[model samples]
Target: EEPWTLFTDGSSCVDGSGAGLILINPDGVEFTYALRLQFAASNNEAEYEALIVGLRIATQMGVKNIQANVDSKLVANQVLGTYVSKEDNMIKYVEIANGLVSGFKTFSISQVPRSKNKKADALSKIASTSFAHLSKQVLVEVLETKSITGKEVTAARKIRLKARQYEVMEGVLYKRSFLTPWLRCVGPLQAEYVMKEIHEGSCSMHAGPRSLSGRAGESQVPDRRNGLLHEMDRSKSGGNDYRRTSEEICMGQYCMPLWYSKRNNLGQRTMVKSSHGDTPFSLTYGTEAVIPAEIGMPTYRTTAVDVVNNDKELRLNLDLLEERRELAAINEARSKSKMTKYYNSRVRGVAFQPGNFVHRSNDANHAAAGGKLGPKWEGPYEVTDALGNGACKLRSMDETILSRTWNVANLKRCYL
Candidate 1:
């Protein structure tokens, strides 16, 4: 039986850097290369870049079987779909790596302990040195293995189920957790299978959030789907544009408390009656009955009539004109009032096309105006394509990271 060899490493320098990649077959033949990248990148980025380099080499060489390994927990977990990319730079790296994986015919990635991956580590350190340069040749060889298959159940590529889990919502299939090259390329059914395998311990599950040691408390399932249109949540956006029309408003705050209670029907009627009575324009009993002594006649004072009539006329005239037309003049004045293109700017944005590598900020607002980022934005992510108007599909430019789609607002173009 032919033994499989693993090639893995990273490269870096003070000014700029690149990742070093090496692939070895059972016979001890070595395939090596390096990726030259700009300076000031994180060590994790180098790891993912190295993985991409190795995978690229593997695909080109037509190696159908692989078991690439990395020492970085972040790179491994991310590629395995166990971690979420929170930093802006990380998001980009994740996206790029995902893209490369899909482009291959057969591929899978795993993370291993640093102590167990000395060869890849050595190659990475070598690439970071000043003598490091990309090798233009591809190397391959066949070799023997003491035991190609061992009792390393933990290293299996299938999803590993742990104690923690997510409940499948009604009617919703367990879609793949959008976290790999091979599973992503196969489509949704593979996702379902992965879910089953994960629950059964075949693959190592990342168990996001569920594994956190917290006292049993109320957990709010936040609505993650984009609202009514694309509006942000109230806590984040301050206002909701999807407000119900007043005609659809049968009740307000006061009615809500008892709205579903046993006395709700009676309570609502009483509240509605009280509201109607409190209005300024209502029938009032005169000091003396106007009709036959006890008969009350509703009286409208001249002053009240004049005020009501005048207000009604004003509203009628206003309703006849378009609000947009009226606002147009005001908007024009404001537009001209600003001397720059970015005054009182509601948002900052740029258009990105498919296949452009960009870094997505981990900030909730997608690198919104202020705050310190770990390394600011990081990526050489390939934009798979733009999704509608506000979101973009991204694959990690590096294979060591996971691939996922994100909103355009979260991304900043990588100049490099």
Candidate 2:
């Protein structure tokens, strides 16, 4: 019978440590697996772990014959009964590997150059890197230890129990809560980004952590209709002044927004805007403006007006104006939401944290030195503090804190 082939590799990084393996049956059907080693593990241990895991998978698949390839010379020689494992842990790993290999009717393992084992290496990188988000396609498992000697898994279980919350659905992990729906779990690195977004995002108020948490959780809900209704009831701003009014007026009057040297912006002030759903003049005056055309011809509103009638009608309009303002505010918020969504689709977000090195926009120092050709950014300053609202405190190489916090918009990360 043709022998199955297995390739194994391991990777370790600041983000995480993990192993990977590739299995190809005699018929050439391939299977790839990535093992996320949650426990802190050295590269050599990871190598052995990958081989052991691959062996177990092969055994379970009922493969009678298998040939394994590994990139690590030490692991390959030790398993082959050539170079002896001097360390206690290495010796145990060798013993465990031998036990798994014995199950196959025929088996052979050899050391191959790392380049030859690229597929396994690539898969290993997936587990070694911390992801901002995981899709349902990734198959995640707890991988309870093969034996009681697996202290890492046991310790992790204890730590999870203390948190008293969490669940895995469709291979994606989420945090459980008694009063609220599950919150998707974020990696330590991604958690910092989540906090920053909640603090500086458009919908956020500079409220305390409780408010931030509540809002962040609600953002994931499937339906926003209920929230929109609540927002309409609570909103009061009334979109009294639509910012695009001047732009729209200028565009309609002239092709470009030329600084109309002679023309006053009366058109902008009187025109209706979609966001506010009313004219600026109407909002400010609390009554429909008498347009020039209407004044020329005299519409019903203008014809019917008298001094005694005008005062009573204006007062009535003023009385019902509050309700209109609330609806306008809700419309303004919805319009802003659409704009924000479009803006975000084109922009990729960047996250910065304390201790990150960044270059600040050069002000007078570089401008005066080089005039028009001056450098745009300067200084590899260290981020000493990430103040809320996209602001940060920086320090120079000497380690003294700068006098003020800088906006992140004017900074770019300085990578070595």
Model 2 stretches with alpha carbons more than 4 Å out = 136-416
The lowest-lDDT stretch of 10 consecutive residues in candidate 2 is: 252-261
Candidate 2 vs. true structure, TM-score: 0.33
**lDDT (10s digit) by residue, model 1, range 300-366:** 2221345647767656545643543445445556656663545538566577898677887755434
Each candidate's clash count: 20, 0
Model 1 weakest lDDT span, ten residues long: 252-261
Provide TM-scores for the models. 0.29, 0.33
Error of 1 at 358 (Å): 99
Against the unseen true structure, what C-alpha lDDT does each candidate score? 0.50, 0.69
Off by over 4 Å in 1: 1-4, 11-16, 104-106, 132-416
